[model samples]
Target: MTQTEKYIWLLNTIHRSRGRGLSLKEISDKWRDYMAKEKPLDRATFNRWKAAIELQFKVDIKCNKSGGYRYYIANPEDIEDDKVSKWLLDSVSMGTTLMGNLDIKDRILLEQIPSGLVHLAPIVAAMKSNHRLQITYRGFGSYFSSTFPISPLCVKLYKNRWYVVGQCFYREKWQEMIYGLDRIEEARVLDETFKYPEDFNAENFFEGTLGVSLYEKVKIETIRIRVEYPHAHYVKTLPIHPSQKLIVDENGEYAEFDITVRPTEEFFMEMLRGGALIEVLSPDYVVEQMKGWVNDLYNVYNRK
Candidate 1:
């Protein structure tokens, strides 16, 4: 068999093994026995072939993640459906599209997400069942509480992280809540099914908010941001928010933009991460909130 054929066979074998990592000895033994009557593979040749597979895929195939030297792709299944597999592979290959200008390490980590999808299955199952899930979430600013009897609407990916948007019983209304799959310690599908409101539209649910939390009391307001030079170049192509409108200043050598969204904590944290490269210039409340957050950060750091 050619290298491509061998690689396909290898991927199939690994996928058949399920979540259990397969050992090199086991793989080599099986390959040798299975192809003995046909194109026999020697031990040394098999090892080289394995190395080539790992290098081509950029996966830690030989890494000792499962106690011993086991071959495991980031995702167990090398999906055979040409269309679906191509789209999935393309999503990871085109990381910049999913995560804007990610660094090498960030890109590699993002690619590892498919493996983590193993955890997302339960959330999906829960949603399908019309049951609730118990999750511990720590957002960018705050952390606390379990979402009891949360009416799960859908699961989505933003910036390569999986979040389940659902209704919080505590809040007494449909609210867009984002819980990272990795942070979700435990999830249970309740026997009682929730009656998801027919009027609830997942797409428009959090349309006004920057992240997930939406406050009904406040309306989505326009806020302007100024990005200092050099980084301004990054902003031109990759915007901070979809609502952003860019305005270039010839003499200032900087980029200024405005976005209309509910200024939630998550929204403020987005600007905080941008540091000095970007500054929130408008909406007195937003500017004050940013200052308050900076003061809180100073208090925490100054003591230590």
Candidate 2:
């Protein structure tokens, strides 16, 4: 194996071992066996690899002297919670898995995301440098495109698409807007930089809403949904939202769940996607709104 592959193997070993921790001898033996070579990792070489791994992956490999000098990730939580690190690990894992089974490429299905990635590098660079961007963008269904200046705050990924949320100066007063990366015809980073709002947190910005579209002025409410049969089982296993809670008949034929979130269009669309398996149960206005939408669908289909 090459040096890069060896480093990845070391990371995978340590990451899988986790709390158990791996002794120097055990790691050396595994490395020797994995590479199918007789040469074992010497102390100096192992130390060098460990330092390089820490620098490259930002994962600290520390030794526990009291536990027979076993090595483990010092901050596993950071690695798990960090978006960039998680994506890196996931990509590496997927790539390695695919490499081992290249003959079955046709058997596996993958989702295609064409637009978000093309300009990701420049957007990320602009965000890092706190630079303003002159973006030429066209929204869906619009005949004309417009060029505007915006202060790129952060980039977010939702439902396989990337969106950049920032301060747009096109209006009389600067207002926060979300620009789909795919819709951006061109993005040029300006030399002038702007201050990223001190209290603006990307995660918290969309905390009360479902998906990327946030109705900033909308009030968040507890949305109750009644789900029937097999679909309830699916929702139980994979919650619709982080705040989802089972309110009634969890293991029975039907179940009710409560989720505290804004009644955004995306949230309603998700509920609609459940078809006959789910029903909106509460917050009179939302229930009526859903009924109205259903009626509209019926009218469209039943029209002469």
Candidate 3:
């Protein structure tokens, strides 16, 4: 294993042993076996790695002396809760798995995302310098494209597509707008800069909502879904939204989840993902809206 991979493995090992920390011998044996090496991990190298890990990741690896000198990560939950750290770890894990299976790379099928990655760097550069961007954009259904100046606010990725949220002078007033990266025909970072809002949080703007569709008039409401088992298992493991809460879980039957979010079109598609296994059950209007969707589907497939 590479030196970097070794450090990550140690961090992961110590992080996993949260309740009862691992001993030096236990960690060394596991590392040796994992790499299929003849020699076990040495103490001096391990100590160097411990220090390096602390320096690079700012993660403290402390030992419990009274508990047989076992090592554990200090405040393990911090890294777990950090989105950037979690993403880095997960990405590295995937890379390691794929790297080892290069022989069967042809057999591995991956999802195809839109080709808008080229504009990502330029957009990020503008965001970093607090500069404005002049972008030539064409919406999905529109026949014409428009070139406009936008003050970079934040960038988001959803459904394998990237989007940039920016402040633009629209309808004679300044307002925030979301534009898909794919929709951008041409984007250039302008020399002019605009002051970024100090109180603006990119995460908060997208929170309590699913996907990228944003509506100014949409009301945030509590949506309750009755997802039958089989589908319930999947929903429980991977929640539809961050605000998902299990209202009722009937073993071997069904589960009901309460999610507080803006009922956007993308959110509607999520509810329909499970087919008959899912049912929307709350707020008379939301239920009626879902019923209309079902009726529309029924009329299309079962036309008289």
Candidate 4:
């Protein structure tokens, strides 16, 4: 393991031993095999690492100085609720796990994100420097490709596909848009650096929106969905949205959930994912839209 990876490994190790903290000896012993060099983890180095870990990841590894000098993550519950830090911790843990289980690679069946990944590095590099990215993109439903200059802002991964959101000139006017990484044919970082918007928040861009579909004129409204039986259990466990509430729960036979989101194509597709198990209950337009889709499916599948 590298220096950063070793720190992550140590963080993961201590996080696992949350209730009962781990002694320095135990940490060193557990991390022995993961070391890049044969050098022992001395007090000075470990102290430096502890400080660095806290600074880098915003994770506090407090030592029971008065007790056994055992170290543990302070307020471990905070990490679980913290999206960014928690995700980082989980990602590092996965990497370490995969590294250890390399021999069982054949046994692990993993779904892969297909296409347009080659431009990630260049795009990220451009974003880091606030430079523009000249990308040759080929969006869906078009026979031809187009080259354009886009100010690299942020990237998000959803449903196993990577999407880059940025401000770019398109159609006729300059507008902020999302482009799938797979759609980018070629990307190059330009020397001209653009000012990264101070007011624009990346997280807020996708706020109140489901999936990565960006529509200029999105109709944001409350949508109620009726889920029946066992499928209701799925929604209960993994809710469709943060606004989702158990408005009506009757006899465990069915349940109603409310989610306030833009009923975009992606939103409709998410509802459609339930097939016949889910039904749009409110807002006549959305219901009619769902009915229209069901009718189309019925026509396709209903062969007499």
The candidate that wins on TM-score is 4
Each model's Cα RMSD? 13.1, 3.3, 3.3, 2.8
TM-score of every candidate relative to the true structure: 0.53, 0.84, 0.83, 0.87
Using TM-score as the yardstick, the better of models 1 and 2 is 2
TM-score ranking, best first: 4, 2, 3, 1
What would the per-residue lDDT of candidate 3 be over residues 1-304, giving only the tens digit for each residue?
Answer: 5777767778887887886999999999987776664488788989999998898777899999999989998878878888767666666666666766778999999898898789999999999999999999999999999999999899987878999999999999988999999999999999998999988899888877788887647788999999998889999998888899999989899999999988878877887778899999998898998888888888999986
The global C-alpha lDDT for each of the candidates, from Candidate 1 onward, is 0.68, 0.86, 0.87, 0.85
Total clashes, candidate 4? 0
lDDT of 4 by residue, 129-218 (tens): 899999999999999999989998899878879899889977887678899999899998988889998888887887768878866497
When 1 and 4 are scored with TM-score, the better candidate is 4
Best by lDDT: 3
Provide the lDDT at 233 for model 3: 94
lDDT of 2 by residue, 217-282 (tens): 789999899999988999999899878999998566889999999988888889889988999999
Candidate 4: pairs in clash: none
Candidate 4, poorest ten consecutive residues by summed lDDT:
31-40
Better of 1 and 3 by lDDT: 3
- Flag the better candidate by lDDT, 2 or 3: 3
Q: Candidate 4: misplaced stretches above 4 Å?
A: 33-42, 75-78, 246-252
Looking at model 1, which ten-residue stretch has the lowest summed lDDT?
Answer: 93-102
**Which of candidates 1 and 3 reaches a greater TM-score?**
3
